[model samples]
Target: MADITAAMVKDLREKSGAGMMDCKKALNETAGDMDAAMDWLRTKGLAAAAKKSSRTAAEGLVGVAVSGTKGAAVEVNSETDFVAKNDQFQQFVRDVTQVALDGAGDVDAIKAATLPNGKTAEDTLTTNVATIGENQSIRRVKRLEVSQGAVVAYVHNQQSAGLGKIGVLVALESAASNDALQALGKQLAMHIAAAFPMALNEEDLDADLIERERAIAAEKAGESGKPADIVAKMVDGAIAKYRKEHALVSQLFVMDGKTKISDVVAKAGKDAGAEIKLVDYVRFQLGEGIEKEASDFAAEVAAASGVPQQPAPVN
Candidate 1:
């Protein structure tokens, strides 16, 4: 049997908000598997099913640029947050996003596009790195536009024009008035920034994520000891709830918290005197899910100078 340590129990309890003894028992029952232990605790009604949402581990910057019918967003990643704050680097990202808007949303196209100083985007980035003295890369870019409707952009923390840490783009395809659609689009972009919906709809959600959610829901439903029909119904209800929570169009608007987003769009169409459809949205939160190695500059200098380092003190 695997050893169930006190630290493991404590971690589980912290994640689930379960009693320490209950967490320990769950860990023991699951043979020290953290995920299984979480499930065990949930089955025993000691932990909530939503506890797993905290495990996301990614990181990078998100930026958006909008021009008329076209808008583009890009995520540029550096090793540290200090690098993200460099004025030169921020300007670089802002410029690159404009390039992305012009380059058919293709990374390579943006890289090869010419900068104002007669150098390509890639060359400019290299030159900037030499001057700025930090490692940086363009991670990803996405573009959205509508032939008939307005594309609106929002920046969560505005550092300058067309630059911020978290950026969002909302595209509405409609025959609606430009003014009306622009207002609605901006509101929707703000909603996207605040809500962080996983996808445009349930269909666009990640397959692996859907499966993982289903597995967790199934495990939780199985403990009801209901008949097969009832258990299946419970699983379906759980999935529907998850979809409503994660999907953009189906989610309740965070603003009013009463109307669904789909209903909001429908009403906006009426207000605009034409049909308006939410085509797409992109939201980028800075430094999400990126594990960065901590740097110790003094230790690095000492190592270079041939000095020994002291070990960390034990707790």
Candidate 2:
């Protein structure tokens, strides 16, 4: 049997948010394998989701660049937010984002593209990491283009001109004037940032997410002790509400908080004397879906002193 080391236990504990002893036990059960230990903790409901372990809980900037009808957004992550403020780091993010605008939205392709300094983006990033004294990475890249109309970009809480915590792109496909299309697109991009819609429509939402919601609704409805038909209707109602709340077009516009987004676009198009279609959108919230390690000073002290840590009291 492989011996479980204290460092392994601590690492698993941080990744899974499980108790120290639980992590040690899982490691032992899994023969000191980190991945298997994580799975073991999850199967026992002692750990958070597996994706928590893979979360890029780093700090950096999400940079955006737009060239005429095409726009690109990229997330360049650094070990610390301080590094994000570095001029060198910011410049690298901006350059990479522009590189992504021309390349396919694939990270590998973008990384392989040539930079203005006559170096591959990947090589430049490596040089930056060595020079900046912090590990950094190009996490993701996305591009949006419209055959006509406008593809608008917006940065929320921008730290720099085109870099920020949240970057959004709205692709409007229409024959509308650029002025009108751009105005509507910017509003839509702002809405995307505020609303955080999951998809353009209900049909576009993830099937697994819909199923998970349905299971939760069914379980809640089953506990109500109503007739099966009534319970079924309750579940359906819950799903419908969930779908509307998550879908971009069905969500209420953030500006008015009353008008639906689809209606807003329709009204904007009518006023502009052109038919506008919101083809797609992308919103990248920095460090989103990345679970940061919880800082529990008391728990840390207790663990270090080999004392059992007690759960916090309910408020």
Error of 1 at 248 (Å): 0.8
- RMSD, each candidate, Å? 3.9, 7.4
After the best TM-score superposition of candidate 2, give how far the Cα of residue 263 lies from its true spot, in angstroms. Answer: 0.7
The Cα local distance difference test for each model comes to: 0.80, 0.87
* Predicted candidate 2 versus true structure: per-residue lDDT over 87-161, tens digit per residue: 999999999998988865889998889999899999999999899899888888899998888889999989999
Query: Residue 3 CA error for candidate 1 (Å)?
Result: 10
TM-score of each: 0.82, 0.78
lDDT at position 293, candidate 1: 45
lDDT of 1 by residue, 41-152 (tens): 7666788764244232333356688888889998887766677778778777878887888754777877888866688888988987798777778877899978878889
